[model samples]
Target: MGYTIKDTRHLKNILRADFILGGLTAFTGLVFFRPLEGFLGLSQPFIILVPLANILYATAAFTLATAQRNPSIPLLRLLIGANWFWTLLSVALLYVHYTNVTTFGLTTLLFQIVIVGTLAYLEGNQLEKMA
Candidate 1:
């Protein structure tokens, strides 16, 4: 098909990383309900948003991985932009205290933001290399 695996290795690897991270996030989100609600004392809506965010992350990861299979720069760029947007939203969430939260919840949220931001940064570098 005139395509070499080496040609897309960088993007493929980045996408794979995001995919794995998303999977882990979603899995953790499953148990997050109790801790987020009980320990953090989060409200119904915000707590529900946690799992929804995980779903979005999973969806984005799947789309990115699919895009990597064909290696479309524009599509990858759009997805990367969305990931950065998510990171920013996560940052905003840090300041907005719609409900109470424990140290664990706050720390977990911050760490997740850092993880996603780092992934986006790496992906950006890979995209630059692709160019």
Candidate 2:
């Protein structure tokens, strides 16, 4: 199947949204890690590393979103894979810390899982259409 221009636009939008959300997550984690550590009851390394990882992911997302032509299928596949990985990782973290995580922390993890998973699904669906 061939993709239309509209499909390209939709893919770009999804990538852009992922970039924006990831940037926000990174910024919030970096700026408020001290408080987040206490509130989330997670390790300091986890708090700091997540934001760093997000920074890289966001940069990749933005680059792909702004490509002059349609982004490559392989790259999009990798992005979708990363989104799924992050979603699953969040779920694992939630499970690991369920006993100690604050209500707010649990909520935060749930939101991350849902949002990232949704993005992964959207990206994957778009890719399937292109394929």
Candidate 3:
């Protein structure tokens, strides 16, 4: 089955929303990483990975929001790629316990994966529909 023009357009709008949501998720991850670790006893990776991911996400959020306002396919494609990579890495690392991560850490990681995976799913669907 094919998507109608309206459906495609709606999906594009949804992609923008998804991007905005992803940005929020990233920002949340950035801010909460430390607090969650110190107070909540959730062990996360070291400085580089945590901050870097959030920074990237924040940057992507701005880029995607701009793309949505500007209606740029290239920008959308870039965001789609970023989301795929981010989600894949997140899922891969979500369960790896070679290091010492607490139960809270594991549960939080799973929760984060769900949120990120949803965003990825939205982005993928939007991209496919746009095609």
**Best candidate (score: lDDT):** 2
Residue 40 in candidate 3 has what lDDT? 34
* TM-score against truth, every candidate: 0.74, 0.90, 0.62
Least accurate 10 contiguous residues by lDDT in model 3: 1-10
Candidate order by lDDT, decreasing, is 2, 1, 3
lDDT of each: 0.69, 0.87, 0.58
lDDT of 2 by residue, 1-131 (tens): 65433488888999999999999999999999999998988777998999999998898889889999988776777888999999999999999999988888889899999999999998887864445
Runs off by more than 4 Å, candidate 2: 1-6, 129-131
Residue pairs clashing in model 3 are none
Clashing pairs in 1: none
TM-score of model 2 (CA atoms):
0.90
- Counting clashing residue pairs in each candidate, in order, gives 0, 0, 0
- Candidate 3 Cα outliers beyond 4 Å, as residue runs: 1-20, 29-32, 39-48, 66-70, 128-131
Best by TM-score: 2
**How does model 1 fare in lDDT?**
0.69
Among all windows of 10 consecutive residues in model 1, the one with the lowest summed lDDT is 1-10
Clashing pairs in 2: none
